[model samples]
Target: MARIKVRARAVDMLGRQQIAGIPTAVHELFKNAHDAYADNVRVDYFRADELFILRDDGIGMTLEDFEGRWLTLGTESKVGANDPGKRVWTGPRKATVRAITGEKGIGRLAIAAIGPQVLALTRSIRPEGLGSLVVSLIQWGLFEVPGLDLEAIEVPVVELQGDALPDLEVVTGLADRIRANISHLGDQIPADMRQRLLSELDMADFDPEAIYSQIDGPKLAGDNFGTHFFIRPTNPVLADDIEQSDDAGSEATPLEKMLLGFGNTMMPQSGEPPISAQFWDHREDGISRDLIGGAAFFTPAEFDSADHHIEGEFDEFGQFTGSVSVYGQPARQHTIVWPDSSGRPTECGPFRLRFAYLQGLLKDSRVPPDEWARLSGKLNKIGGLYVYRDNIRILPYGNSDFDFVGIERRRTKSAQDWFFSYRRIFGAVELTHARNSNLVEKAGREGFRANRAYREMTSMLENFFERLAIDFFRPTSQFGSEFNSMKAEINQEAKLLAKRATKTKERQGEFKTELDTFFTSIEKGHPTREAERIRAMTEERLSAVATIKSPEAAADALLNAEADARRAVAALEKSITVIKC
Candidate 1:
């Protein structure tokens, strides 16, 4: 036999070794489906095997696009920068459009972890003025895979064969196996199962290609062209004895696999109010902000309970472990005050932690209200959570320490209270995640620019603020006594001055006469006397202005001179119908 050798394959983003087990890859597929404007997608199980199926009423794909869209890995249909001004894909009405999320494009290789089967079918969907083939799209053939002994076997990186779609029979058998696989999963399904599946299975509500129902308001909208996903584990399609099972675990079907879904759409921007918080005089005593537009789901038949995690599902690195942030406000813009090498804040540099308040908004089981209030002062805010929305994206600008928002002052001043409150989060997630100054700088610039362009930059900062407030800050001790002293100082100043007033009638009368003479002279073209009087008056007021030390002094002089004038207005207000609390 001739000697042959092969080089080792490198790991891409969707490599099986990169993800914990199976769920991560499925997540990629669902992401793709959303980009395609799929209304509802289901990964069903039958015959103890997994059958991955995603259907969208959006523009269907043709054979030409199968290689470009489905067959390609690391594709993102929604990868462009977010825009509030451009309402094109803001809600959900594109069938053939794509999104940007996955970077490696290696999700194809991950299919091995699901099963040995794969297929994709597609058709073209055109816009109203355009013809049928404007943009080619594809429907993935019912993808199926055989059980493989993956325990000791490292996944070999390989590409899918040819540009053809899978057969319809494969899809039918896959659907059948979806049912069979569910039975195989039996009781195990309930542990990882979620209640959200039943609704996701209702495909009509989720097509991404069709524009959805209505536009609610600014910072809120209704999903029209729907795109969503539902998935679950399956029973044993392979003979139990012949199965390539791992000592640490046995095989599971795709339908039996954990599921996640996402969707996007455009809404009429008519009701959207201009974005700003200066008008928010006080807290909003409402139920929710209704900002985020997606859901996390587990089949009721699978998990039975809504527990947030499944233990053994992650790799030893604990990367695939579940984490969720519910309640409070949605992700907010981050602040990176530092400039890049060019010394511009939005250009490049290290990272900076953006800060915001988002507590009492989330309905999660977590949060301690009293403690959060205490943490608020440290936050220099109230009733808000501080967290990072997206992983800070860093752009290299030489090797210098160009950290913009990574300073301890930034974290301590805006986020310290919250960070400390959640200090022990699985050890030190806050400290580790926020330490990347390089990333923060780039992301902040991007966000600042996006904000100006009316973009909703993604970040996990709300949850970050909440966790920090809960674990890091003491309920009554986020800040020092000095902060309290400042509040007291303001109150003292207000009280001292409220009872006093300004304006002495005699002095006022003289000043008024001088002003009238000066203005009258100017109109009569007599500048000399007017100019002199103005000079004298200005010279006299200087002394008064200098002698004034505090508002109280100003108040005292005016009150003594005009005490009688105050009574009229005060009495009228007091006599009014009601006072709002």
Candidate 2:
């Protein structure tokens, strides 16, 4: 019989290559904390030192649990594989139980995607008493060497008594081991390549003890047992992943963009445990600042300024029961029953959705001009429909560049009639792993897999928008009323102008008769030089008035004015008809 063997490179492939980017790597860590019933998690980055640390105040692991579960790849402990009825309690008190967000058990490997080496320290709180602290040093570079089996790469694990964390000497010893592991590969590779890899370690100035003192001394004081990670990114690309801006024009770093929605993704329902997350950036000047300080992507003002709003939940029957508010009107109960082609209960399950339609134009909004301008600027940068599962956001959905629901493509078909565009609406589709197990996220954390459940969810969203367009957006729009008012005003002005033109023609006739009488009187009275000049000028004016009163010219002018007004009204009517169709 032949047995299967795993290579050392499998760790590199699963950790560094499986995860998509830095943001996803951080998200996996946060999910792990959530599953442990953590109330708070803090992420810190030291730009000058290229050091990254994450601390969570959760129920940490014991040395036994660390060895049996944490070190075992693809562990099924969280999934209850052996005992189907087993329930995992989240907090140390066992008061709250949460469905585990992770099932594949490969999330621990995501740490390698951010850095080449990691130091993990954890202290467990069991029902009997506090357990000893478990320390582990993971050298990811060891897995990269050729001709090495997975079991041959040894990870150093230590058990310390009574919250005794690693000191400077312990950290230096681990660093030396990493250097030795890389140098040991010299027999398999060239000598110059070995020197280059050794130089990249830069371990002379590596200091984890100072970082621990700066963080743990004040935070983890007095009976605080949790997990902390100290990571040193030796690769320049990995360091730039956290510090550089996501776009050329953006001032916000990639880390800042990811943390902006921390703890703000969903409003907690009754009995739901709340989690808080924060990010601290240590600048080169030795000053630290919180990147996301209670800032929300959407403000109340933006919600209030929305022209249309729909919020409700979809039942398992593929029916939506909710209220729809249009243009500041009172919200009314609205329901939509989406017909499923499969003729079965929806596989997507039950979820809640909240959407706000913004016109993104000042003239269309009732908000104050200054406030609207500021909100518009924000909407332009962070406008899209977002997805959150168990109050945690799924990435690449709400980003400015991602059009997950196909709104942009739909708008291209009927751009004018379709009132909703990707940038003009803000939405959130809330899901839970317990109810929406079929709508699974991809391994890379980019988006949901293109499964039947995902397709059904997106199709339902599109149907909702279509219903909104036909029932509310088109009917309540100001275009029809404003166009009608304009047409009426133009017709009235045209009639008044024709009346004035006719009155002017009658006045010219009367004035001509009076002037002719005056000229005759001047000719009979005297033949002085001034009188002769006045009579000649009066005759010239009277002759011009006679030409103005000609039947052909007067009739032509009235007819032309009426024709122009009729054409204008007809054009407006045609436009309205097209819009309605």
Tell me the deviation in Å of residue 130 in model 2: 1.5
C-alpha lDDT score of every prediction, in listed order: 0.30, 0.69
- The all-Cα superposition gives candidate 1 an RMSD in Å to the true structure of 24.2
TM-scores of all candidate predictions against the true structure: 0.32, 0.75
Q: Which stretches of candidate 2 lie over 4 Å from their true place?
A: 81-86, 93-95, 178-186, 189-209, 216-221, 238-253, 262-273, 299-305, 475-581
lDDT of 1 at 16: 42
lDDT of 1 by residue, 1-581 (tens): 89643222222223444544454455455444444444443433222212233333344444445445555544664344232233453223433222233344434455444443333333443343211211111111112111211121121111213322223333344344434443453543343331222222222121212111211211101112222121222213322322224633222222122221122111111121111101000112322221112211111221111111111111211112232222222222222111111222321112223122223212221234454443332222111112221221111110012222232334456653543222111110111122222223221111223331111112222333343334323335433233234335545654544434243455566667766765675577655544455556545655565588888886675554344334544543343323221
What candidate 1 gets wrong by more than 4 Å, as runs, is 1-20, 45-52, 67-99, 128-343, 346-419, 423-581
Ten residues in sequence with the least summed lDDT for candidate 2: 572-581
Instruction: Find the candidate with the highest TM-score and give its number.
Output: 2
